[model samples]
Target: MNASSPIGIFDSGIGGLTVAHAVTRLLPNENIIYFGDTAHLPYGDKSSAAIQAYSIKICNVLLQQKCKVILIACNSASAAAYELVKEYVGSKAKVINVIDPVIDYIDHHYRGKTVGLIGTKQTVNSNIYRKKTDALGKDIVLKSLATPLLAPMIEEGFFNNNISESIIYQYLANEELSGIEALILGCTHYPLIKSQIDSFYKENITILDTSEIVAAALKKYLSQSSLLNNLNAYIRHFYVSDYTQSFERSTQIFFGEQIRLEHYPLWE
Candidate 1:
């Protein structure tokens, strides 16, 4: 519960590294402990009960590490397990999810606008963003599409090329996402292919960068709570429940560097 304690972040896979990298860049003095549940990735396809169970387990691991704050960095987990984890963590640590910050941003800036969202099946089907916006009682219209292929494709290192562009274009071209003022990259993995997506729209439509928005929200919370670290040196730890060379190598794509990953299996 102190400023020096590391910030905990977890996702179904390396996609969460995008948020981890943003946090590191924004708060270099603060320590970070990131966990990727590579053993059961693409949580987009898993049941809500299963996502809740896995999220609680991951939070337990982060709590054991004495994390001062825990972030559900995956959209699927945020949609399915945020409330459960917050209740389970209780007073042990602060809990933040990737969805709320973006929602808040939209509420403040895009009221009465038609916004589009593209995410995994789990996130889109959950209708979290739609429900949250509706609760605001604003004139916001949200159109959501389940871009299930994008996340897995990014994890496999398929982006910044013709193959990736074609898929990106195909998804963006869908009638469901048309006529929107902006598009939300609802999945963290989508940021890896953000440039391709950006090129697809040619900057005509705004593409929300969820990681940066979430990072700013984290900074604001720490500053307001007096939990901001002032130290000059800090350590960053990356852990995965299960590991493969591909996951290890893909760290650079998500994290902006070739950081070492420690294998820490939750099932064992």
Candidate 2:
């Protein structure tokens, strides 16, 4: 593949759209192909081995599509399957995950702040955030809550419905997120619930979106590798293990603008 080839990105589900959108905004001239494994959404409950298998499958599919670089846009998959994909990508392609960049961003920007994390059970248990933040020499007081329901709520097209709002409200009610100066939306899928998060963060706490940090990291990698694509070209292709209207609704929620999306199957 040439340097001008499009980058491939994938997530367990619609969560990856956040990363894809961020990369597009930063590198508008480059083309992107995104895959969402909606057939097996909410990877939190699945075993690590299962997630790794799925991640490897997605990487192979993306490579066959002629992608020069791959982004494991899902946090769960990144924690579980990044090494597997890295082997396949080798020197020919680079693989970027969404975690390390945000950790670096928070370490540099908000030193010694109380950082609260909300993600899947697996992500919280992985402690990648805690380890990375501590490595930057900042004493970060990290409190994590396993927001298992948020993914399904958003996936089912219930952003503002009774269940979605209730789940979010319940998580915040008894829990003491008060000392947290900033909250990290640890899961990519959580961005769709941004409105509720913003409205609830009226107590002067800052909510840092991981997508921004991921985009900046992606730019740095492209520049360092001399793979920055700038040509008279622009295109984006979307794929899903199973696509549904609910996926479109979730995309619209995160993108801030509706996109004409074409669905492709990855299981073939």
Candidate 3:
């Protein structure tokens, strides 16, 4: 409710750090508290109920930290648990999701255009992008494919090499994603391999930057709501429900630098 309160951002794992990084770069003065539910990594495979439960638990932790806003930075969690989180956090803090800002951008810029989307199985299967685009009545056609391997690959630091390139190429070459004017990186983790994806496309097609879009949206909301932090000095805290050496190492890749991560097990 106040300008000095930190923004809360949560993902199923390190993938959401992409969004966290973007927010930090865009709004350096705002404090941030990030939670990675590593105990339940890849919400993509979980049922809607499970995602909802984890999201609410994370939201409660963020709210306890007095976060002015809570951002669901994972596409799978956003698709499955956004409404529930929003409703649960009402009056306490604002709740935003990664999907809506991209959808709004598409509505404004890509009307009547064929757009391709790549995400985890849950995000793709949830049909969130297709459904929302259809509701726009804009004649926009959305093609989606589930690239289940990309997140785990990126988390394990497998990108920017031959193995990563081959997998990226194979996914992009899928007929389901062909003939699209733009591709939405539905998963936050996709941005890490964005250069490879651009290389595969030869920069011929537009690759939507979901992190920037979501960050900009957050900025707009904060500005309008009088919650934009103005102080130069700020603090950041990173938490993971479970810890692993790989997750610790991958933080640098997603967050753009080395940062400490505190383990805060929700079930305990």
Candidate 4:
């Protein structure tokens, strides 16, 4: 594995850009190759087999890109397909998902506290976070609100507006988001509304957004496995399964600047 090889990260849609941002902040000198399967924007609504098939398609693209490691940055993709990718990518490249890092963080740092989950319907249904948090012997209460509206809300850059806040309030209407000392922004897109979420809950709530944690975990694994990028070379690649002018415009919130966009016929 070349130290300079780029890391591959994929999401069902543009939300994985959150993960890409963290990787950039954590390993500024390393290259990244990101793929967004935007044709199927919300993985939360798809069945398990559909997610598995879609994940493998993006994984193949990453392999073609010669990525040194792949990050399954989307929660639904991670939940339904990380094991499949790990099995397929076996012994060659590293693959890490967003789940374990959150578990590890809660176990090691948080110790014991109830966690509030705000994610897509699929993630909450899978019970991945709830089971993992409980497995660590932490007396954590799992309260989840499937905020499906958030994906398109952030994608459309609506986080700063009152409409987005109204959506958040509507999503958590029956659930008590005010009480949890710890909140998990289970979707990559949720961090875009972190300030608004914070404003609603106040400052003392410890929000856990795993983009940083996952990036740190990937960095540690790359270092120990001797796959860290070479100090001298850096690069970034952006690929979308479907191209849109709006994508390039919205990417500034995530990617800072629009690099050229490439399209691949994935999930076809």
The lDDT of each candidate is 0.94, 0.82, 0.94, 0.83
Best by lDDT: 3
The digit string of per-residue lDDT tens for model 3 on 1-268 reads: 8999999999999889999999999999999999999999888889999999999999989999999999999999999999989899999999999999999999999999999999999999999999999999999999999999998888778999999999999999999998999999999999999999999999999999899999999999999999999999999999999988777887987888998999999998
Per-prediction TM-score to the true structure, in the order listed: 0.99, 0.91, 0.99, 0.95
Q: Which wins on TM-score, candidate 1 or candidate 4?
A: 1
Q: Give the Å error, residue 1, model 2.
A: 4.6
Per-residue lDDT tens digits of candidate 1, residues 68-178?
Answer: 999999999999999999999999999999999999999998999999999999999999999999998889999999999999998899888899899989999999998
Ranked by lDDT, the better of candidates 1 and 4 is 1
CA shift of 145, model 1, Å: 0.6
- Give me the runs in candidate 1 sitting further than 4 Å from their true place: none
Where does candidate 2 stray beyond 4 Å? Answer: 174-176, 256-268
What tens-digit string does per-residue lDDT give for candidate 2 at 1-268?
Answer: 6668889999888778888888989998888988888788888778889998888888887888788889989888888878887986787678889888888788887887788888898788888888878778888877778888888777767786667877897886546465787889889888777778877776477777888789989999888888889896788888778767767766776666676566666556
Which residue ranges in model 4 land beyond 4 Å of their true spot? 176-178
Comparing candidate 2 with candidate 3, which one achieves the higher lDDT? 3
Q: Could you give candidate 4's per-residue lDDT for residues 1-268 as a string of tens digits?
A: 5888889999977788888998998898898998988888889889989999888888888998888888999998888888999999886678899988888877876765677888888888888887888888867777777778898778878888889999876775555564677888899888788888788766678878878888899888888988877686688888888899888778777766666668888755
TM-score computed on alpha carbons, candidate 3: 0.99
Each model's backbone clash number: 0, 0, 0, 1
Error of 2 at 73 (Å): 1.0
Residue 231 lDDT (model 3)? 100
